[model samples]
Target: MRKPVLTIFYQFNPWSTTIGGIQTLINIFIKYAPPEFAVRLVGTANDKTQPILKWQSAEFAGKEISFLPLFSLKNDNVRSLIPTTVKYTAALLGQCFESDFMHFHRLEPTLAALNWQGEKTLFIHNDIHTQMQTVRDKKAILWRRFPAAYFAVESLLVPQFSQILSCNTDAVKHYKERYKSVSDRVAYIKNSYDNELFYPLNQEEKEVEKRELAQKLGLPDDTRFVLFAGRLHPQKDPTLLVRAIAALNDPCVHLLIAGDGELAAQVRTEIDTSGLTGRVTMLGAVPIAQLAQLHRICNVFVLSSAYEGLPLVVLEALASGTPVVTTECGETPKLLTSNSGIVCRQRTSECIADALRKVLQHPEDYPIESCVETAQPYAARTVVRDIYSEMLNRWEQRVTFAVKV
Candidate 1:
C-alpha cells in the first residue's frame, strides 16, 4: 500500500518559531498524522536573509519530516507585493504538483496555489469577515479597507478546495453561510494543546514553583499573577488588558505578559500611563515549557482580544489548571464553563476588570481539577488523531469516486 503525500502549507515556519497558534496546531497535526501517510511541511523562512527556495529535513518529535522554505518579503508594502506574489506562486506551482493532497493554513498561500488541480484543504484560523471589520490598527485597517476585493477572491477560491476546516464553530457557520455552494465541505475542527507539557500541579508543588518563579522575576511571594500570552497586536487588544488590570486597582495583583509584537511600545506606554509599571512585568516571548510553568503558577489567565478563532492559549491555561478571564470572542463562551473561568459580557476594560476581580477574589470557586477537566477533550493526541482519521477518510472517498469516473 503506497502512502499518500500530504503537503501542509503556511506562511511562516512552524518548527523554528512560536509565532502563533497556527504554527502550534500545524506541529501537532504533523506529529499525530497517521503512519499511513507521508507528510511534508511547506512554509516561508522567518529570517529575511534566508534564500528563497530551499529544501531541508528537520526532526520533530523523533520523526524526520521534509521541509520546503519559500521566499517572502519582510513587509507587505506596494513595493514588495508583485515580486512576493510572483515568487510565491511560481514556487508553489513548481514544487507542489507531486503531493497527493495540499493543506493550507492561510488564505494567501492557498490563493498562490490556486491552480493546484489536486485535492486541497484550507484551514480558517479566524472569522475573516469579522477580523476585517474589527481590526483597529492604522496599517491593518488600510489593507482591510478593500474588503470587497478579498470577498471576490474568496468566492472564487474557497469552493474549489476539497475541504474547509475552521477551529471556531462560529467561523464554520459563517463560511457555510457565505459559501453556500461548498457548505458541505465546511467543518469545525477544534485546536489542541500539549497535555503532556501542560497539566495540573498540586497546591504544594504550585506554591514551590511560584516561589521560585517570583524570586527569579523579582516579584513578591504573595503576588497573584494574571497572565496574557499572545502577540501584542491590535486584534489581541493587549493594551485593553493593561487598562483592565489598572481598573481592578488591586495592589497585590500583578501582570506577567509573555509575548511581544508590533504594539509592544504602545502596551508599555499604556502601562506607564495607567501607573502599572511596578505591578506589570513583560516576560517577552517565553518558550513553551516556561509558558506551561507560568500557566500553572499564575492565578488567572486573561485574553482581551477583539476576535479569535479558538485560542490555544486559553486551552493551554486550562490544561495547566489555571482559571481564565477572557472577553466573549470566537468559541470561548461555549468552551468555558462556570467552574473553568469567566467570559466578560462586554469587551470594555471595566467588564474585564470586574471578571478578573471575581476570579481573583474567589479562587476556590474555580478548582484546579475543574479547569483541567474542561481541557481534557482538547488534548493533542486525541484531537489530532481524530483529525487525521477524518482527512484519510475524505481522501479515500475521493479516490473511490475518481476510480468510478
Candidate 2:
C-alpha cells in the first residue's frame, strides 16, 4: 500500500523568512521526515515577486519535500481579509486535492483550512485564542487586534477538528476550557528542536567555540553572556532581560539579543536608557546557525515572554546543556526541574532579575548532563516520528473502517 501523504498548511516557510521557532520546527521535520510517508507543505510566498502557484521540491531524508507557495496578503484590513483568505485557501486546496491528513499550523491557516477537505488536525504553536483575546481586551492598535475578530468567528467551527496537538500544558488547558464539547480530543504534544545542532559541547569544545564566538562578537574573554533570542514584541517582553540585567549590575554579565519585532526600538531604548549600553548587544534577527552556537556558548538562556504555547528556544537551551531562567509560560516550569534552571514566579522584571542572579550565583548547581538529558526525549526526530505515527494510525484505521462499510 502506498503511504498516506500529509498536507501541512503553514504561514511561514523556513526558507522564506526570519521567523524563528515555527520556522525551526518545520525545518527540523523537513530534514528528518520519515520514509514511511510523503509530506506536502503549503504556505504563502514570502517574496512578493514570486508569482502564485509556484512550487519547489526535493527528496530529504528519504522522504519527498513538496512545498507550494501561494500569494501572501495582509489580514489586518477587514474588506480584503475574506477575499484574500479565500484566494489563499483556494490555491492551497487546488494543490492538495486529496490527502489522508491536513495539518493546520496557526490560527489564520485554520480559518482557511475550514474550506479545505481532509482529516484535519490542529498543531497549536501559540495560544492564539488568548493572544488574540489579550489584544481584544487591551484594545491594542486596530491592525494588531484585527485578526481577533476573525479568530473569534472561525472558532465556532473548531469542534469540527477531531484531533488537536497542544504543544504545552497551558494550550491543553486552554482548549479544554474553551472548547468544552471537544475537550477530549486535545492531547499534549511537546515541541521539538534539532538536537544535532543544539546539543552540549564538552568543556574543551565549548571553550574553543566560546572563544571563537567571543572574538566574532568582539567580547572580552571574562564576559558572562546571557542570551535571549525571540521576537522583541510586547508578548515576548524582550526588555525584561535588559531591565533584569541592568538591575543586577553585574559588569561581567552581558546580554546578546537576537530577534526583531514591533517593540524592537523599545528594547534598544531600555538597554540604552538603563545604562546597559556596553553590557547589551542587540543583533536583530540572527540566522539559525549562529543561534545554535549562542545556545551552547552563552551562560544562561532566558525567555521573558508573558505567554507562550511552547517556546522552542527553551528546549534548544536545555539541549545545549545551558542553564535557563524563564517565565512560567508553556511547559517551561515543568522542564526546569531540580536545579537545571529557575522559573520566575511571575512575569515581572524583578522576578526575572532575582532568578537570573540565583542561577548565575550558583551555576554549579545546574548539571550539564541533566539539562541535556531533559531535552533528549524532545529531539526533532523522535517527536516528529511520534506525531506522524499517531496521525497515520488514526488515518489508516479511518480508511479501513470506510472500506469495510
Best by TM-score: 1
Candidate 1, residue 65: Cα displacement in angstroms equals 0.5
lDDT of 1 by residue, 1-405 (tens): 467788888656654535478777887777777788888877777666555676677777666777777765453212232434445656676454446788887666566676667788888888776788874664443348778887887887887788899988878998999888899999998889987788989988988888887788787888888999987777788889999999999998999998877788989999999999999999876777788889999999999988888899999999999999989888888999999999998999999999999999999999999999999999998988887787678778878898899
Please provide TM-scores, in order, for all candidate models, with all chains considered together: 0.91, 0.87
Candidate 2 has its poorest 10 consecutive residues by lDDT at 74-83
Output the lDDT of residue 94, model 1.
Answer: 47
Best-fitting candidate, measured by lDDT? 1
Q: Please write out the lDDT profile of model 2 over residues 213-262, one tens digit for every residue.
A: 67776777767788998876567777777888887888888889888766
Worst 10 residues of 1 by lDDT: 75-84
Query: In model 1, what are the clashing residue pairs, if there are any?
Result: none
